[model samples]
Target: MTGKIYIIGLGPGPAGWLTPEASAALEKVTDLIGYFTYVDRIPPRDGLTIHGSDNRVELDRSRHALQLACEGKIVGVVSGGDPGVFAMAAAVLEALEHGPQEWRALDIEVLPGISAMQAAAARLGAPLGGDFCAISLSDNLKPWSLIERRLQAASDGDFVLALYNPASKARPKQIFDAFALLRKLRPAQTPVAFARAVGRPDERIVLTTLGEADPGVADMSTLVMIGATTTHLIERPEGRPFVLTPRSYEANR
Candidate 1:
């Protein structure tokens, strides 16, 4: 019997946001594996076991999850944000393929959840309605040069961009480089939104412009939203802060 391995995204951090399907998957899993902080968010489920680890040990954690699945133990690997976007899905898949031949027969499924970019865009209101792209500034896995090229392409294409893993302890200058590239193609006044600790108790969303969105606004947990060429600032009639991205299709007519 082949064991099933599930990569599940827990969303930002409120249990109420967990989907019924995800919750049901959680209920069926014999073992849960994820970063320590994310594991703490899940409520205790009957007959579920957990494997938690510090954030630094990605390879070790992936191996552990694969091992459990190989042993015919249903495994659920959790990630806080959407598994596909700068999360565990890639790492888990990479490990399974490269680690050993034993992992070839294991059944692996990736389930999606609310990404921080989607959640933050909702708070800003229609900043990504038209054509858009998402990029992660962290160069831990990919080279910084490739990240720069993506930034330039998105900027030149006038695609609203959602940035994840903007900055981290080791690579503090990544956001700065991204900002420079965007500024070259995008106007300095292009609206940008920085969301920190999104959906959590201490959530903070700041509205600013490209020139004003310095590296100070970024950290490991921050997500950045950059508006498109048609995107502009709009003050809510009720005096709230936000921005709007107008669809280019409207201009064609």
Candidate 2:
């Protein structure tokens, strides 16, 4: 009785942004697997066995999920953001492609979730309103040199950037280094947003320019968004100014 596997993105925090499809998938799964905190985010339900694992063990977690599904246990592997975006969706696919051919024939689905960048963009107005790209700042899977080159290329291409995994206790310097690198390529006034724990009770959003941004404010939970040269601010009398990157390229005619 082989079963299916669902890779679900729980969204930035949890229930707030979970898509109805994702919610249903979670409910249907006999087993839920993911990072410890992400697994805990699911509300307790009957008959769902949750498998919580450590950080940086994505491949192991994914393979295990596939195995469980092959053994007839419907499974859902959760990711905090959209599974396709620097998350478990890729890992699951990688495992399927490399693990066992039989695993490929099983029904597999990727349920989308609101990415942290999307949550950050909404909270900070529309910094990603225009042409933009998302990049993972963590070099755990790739080299730092490649990341630097990509940063420079994004700056050169004049695209607003949404950087994920910007900082963590283990690799704190990368975020600061990234900021420093961008400091040289872009103007000092390029707006940088540090959105921490979006959608969570302790969420924080700090907007600052590249010139005066304090990297110290960011931690593992922060998602950083850097505006392009054309990105601008719109004043609001009541609250903080809104950020927008014009969707049109018509040079302010």
- Measured by lDDT, the strongest candidate is 2
Ten-residue stretch with the least lDDT total in model 1? 244-253
Q: Of the candidates shown, which would achieve the greatest TM-score relative to the real structure?
A: 2
Which residue pairs show backbone clashes in model 1? none
Measured by TM-score, how close is model 2 to the native structure? Answer: 0.97
lDDT of 2 by residue, 195-217 (tens): 99999999999999989999888
lDDT of each: 0.84, 0.90
| Predicted structure 1: lDDT | 0.84
Per-model C-alpha RMSD: 1.8, 1.2
